[model samples]
Target: MSFAPYNDLRRHCAALGFGNQWTEAACALGNERFAACPHGDYPRWKAALDGLPAVPPAFRMREGMPCLGEDFQDQQGLADELMTFHPWRKGPLQLAGVTIDTEWRSDWKWSRIAPHIDLSAQRVLDIGCGNGYFGWRMLDAGAELVIGVDPTWVFVMQWLACRHFAGDLANFVLPQGIEDLPEQEVAFDSVFSMGVLYHRRDPAHHLARLHSLLKPGGTLVLETLVLPDDQADGVLVPEGRYARMRNVWAVPGCERLLRWVAEAGFSNAQIVDVNQTTVEEQRSTPWMTFESLDKTLDPQDSARTIEGHPAPRRAVLIARSA
Candidate 1:
């Protein structure tokens, strides 16, 4: 565990809310806590903080929602909020036998899928990478180079951490989307996308773009919210004077999606994981309160359904480019 002198120290101090006056007092306390703790991850560090009744003023109150802060009300806003969380920093800090540093809520999803990845010698890409969490993990997992592309400034936070700790932002790129990627045809050996497909208005088009970026025989790791049955067509959130027009395209089924991936030039498409847990399963964090959000699928029904109800289940897929 080699630590960078001032740069890494400054970023960590800022993140922990020590600010510019991170003197011996703060450093001593932080170093003591860091040395005493067995797990060096975010959740564990947070748990340690929980035990300490006194916290720095910066972290004393909940700044905003976890990933999606108060500043984020829309998709773009959500992206910006994610940046503030600084997920990459969590990678250096591990906890509870798993790393919880990625932008996604479910760390288990990554654990289940990571084994199948041949990242040691591959060039990887993570699309819609919120704060480049998974991308950072991929780098840690031994990918020669990992590129995370997102439109949000939150990625800048991750970039800052990468530069400060890792000394370069080589593996991450903050492009608006695939269209904006520099001229590098079929460059990546593997591409990973989690929790992004369903948000797109045109899933097929997005798949095509992903296919275009991959080399022949490249692998694409995709995870998204899947509907229970095929009856649920995509939901359209109409544009308002203030609200951005967006569409929530739910996953119909694995077969249909695999076919689309094949059409996009990917073969060997397979679903790797399915999590049916409801929103209630989500832990109460400062970022967002899942319990407060109405989990009822029926518009008229007020009662919250815990089990055996219509809820978005996440599905992970691994596909190989033809």
Candidate 2:
């Protein structure tokens, strides 16, 4: 898989001069890790990328969706080629006149958080960035550069698909996780960790790492599943699967989460928006033909998961590092 956009990102940082040494190092490591990747589907994803017809990289963002390429001949063929990489989880993206109505209405997610943060000329690190969907919104919000890390090779391929049409935009979604990247304490002006907290065994530790990644007085935008304060324990350590997700460990109450954030050395931690996820927000579409949120909910009680846990209610917290 040719990670040309990532390489272009490295070059862009290098051209900016000596201050971006750490970024350069991370970029190099990303390249190395990507090359050494053992994912079984990497070749398939790469082949899909190879199959993308080169219409001019006439990309733009409209209403938060990353629109890729101009309308060309063989529109149905382009859509079919895109369908090769099935289960597109993070988008409702536009590609060569094909509107891929993806599983998640990611534009809504971006809309929720975009109003709370100012990314103008900021350097950002997005952990678990899922095909870098939010990276486009971050750049659109005036972020100077956005580096996103995700472990899934498929999402990286999705990002590559966008890159093929968009050329080298400042947003780069590296095929690596936050844990895999080289350490650069205080490297970012703003850090975002959305929908990734509960998956970790140590929520506080994860917050701490997010704290450490930011510059002095830098912003931390954290979003994760939360149990309602009045309805559950301080932290709900799911005895079994929550919402059909086996990896989910702890989902904190509003107060408990804020306390954890404060304990992790973030100050002025405040909930910006809290919303119970609806089926419309995440459901199966033609582009992502698989079980989705609709299947995760309890049939008898939509407000509860199949395992009887409270249905997904996510909270967005904005705080600052000392």
Candidate 3:
């Protein structure tokens, strides 16, 4: 079956100077990837998405956070339906009278970086956009269009479920990655790569890819895990899992990350925020019942991961394309 959201994305991109040919090809690529998704929960997640209650255009943040709640007669049913897509890691999505308290308080990250970038009338791209939580916030910040890409099947389903209620929204999330886009396309005015850099085995290559996505002098907001100041000029390549995530490859200090951004060909690669992640920012919520930051850290010393590496400290950098 054809993905309705992809159709919407194609139409939206057509009007945004991406041209009909690029839209067609990009959406076709997304469709082929979706068709081949091997996730076991894809069927159930798609069913849940199809069953979401129809609502009007009620996309707004509640008390400075992204929310999609609307008055629904069957509130319990709504809760049950949304729970099928468990492990909601990146949001505190308030959906149809039921609040999904996700693992990460993603709004906190948005607050730290939002003031630095001007999303107003900008075409934005978010790589590793878990469930498109940040994309909604980007639209709220007045972005002309927000296109988020992640290869995870369940996250794509989660985004589709959220988009079903958003109603003709300009923000879209594709089941693709930064590598999937053509090199030096330079289509977006702002590009965000949050919590994704460390996962790449070659982070410099990833930064270069992000640089290629932005237009000349366009802004790039990057947030990723970093080591402490004492480890400046040092990069920790975890022997195994770091903070319970196996994909985490490298965690460099703030200075080293700034250097990496500079080497990637971005100018004004300066650090805007550096804060160690806390349990309050990431914890087990009803929406995410699995192991969280608390479990992954050394109980005796919060300063270290269970694997004894420096605990997760993230840094947000704002750079401009050269």
Off by over 4 Å in 2: 1-5, 17-19
User: For each candidate, how many residue pairs have backbone atoms clashing (under 3 Å)?
Assistant: 7, 0, 0
Better of 1 and 2 by TM-score: 2
Report clash pairs, candidate 1. 40-93, 40-94, 41-93, 41-94, 65-287, 66-287, 83-154
Per-model C-alpha RMSD = 14.1, 1.7, 1.5
Tens-place lDDT per residue, model 1, 160-237, is: 333333333234444245555544344578888776887776888889888877888889999876655453333322
lDDT leaderboard ranking: 2, 3, 1
Residue range 1-322, candidate 3, lDDT tens digits:
6654577787788787765455576677787777777788888888888888986647878865566746678878998898898878988787766777889999898889988888889888899998999999989989988888898878888888787766778878888877786442446789899999999999999998888878889999999998899997889999989988999999998888989999999998889899999999999988899988999999999999999999999999999997
C-alpha lDDT of all candidate models, in order? 0.51, 0.85, 0.84
TM-score of each: 0.59, 0.95, 0.96
Q: Write the per-residue lDDT of candidate 2 for residues 1-322, one digit (tens) a residue.
A: 5554457887766665524656777778778867777888878878888889878877678877888788769989988888877879987788888888889998998889888889988889999998888888888789888889998878888888877877777888887777777765446889999999999998878888898888889999999999975853488889989988999999998988988999999999989999999999999988888899999999999989999888999999999998
Candidate 2 accuracy as lDDT: 0.85
Instruction: Looking at model 3, report the run of 10 residues with the lowest lDDT sum.
Output: 178-187
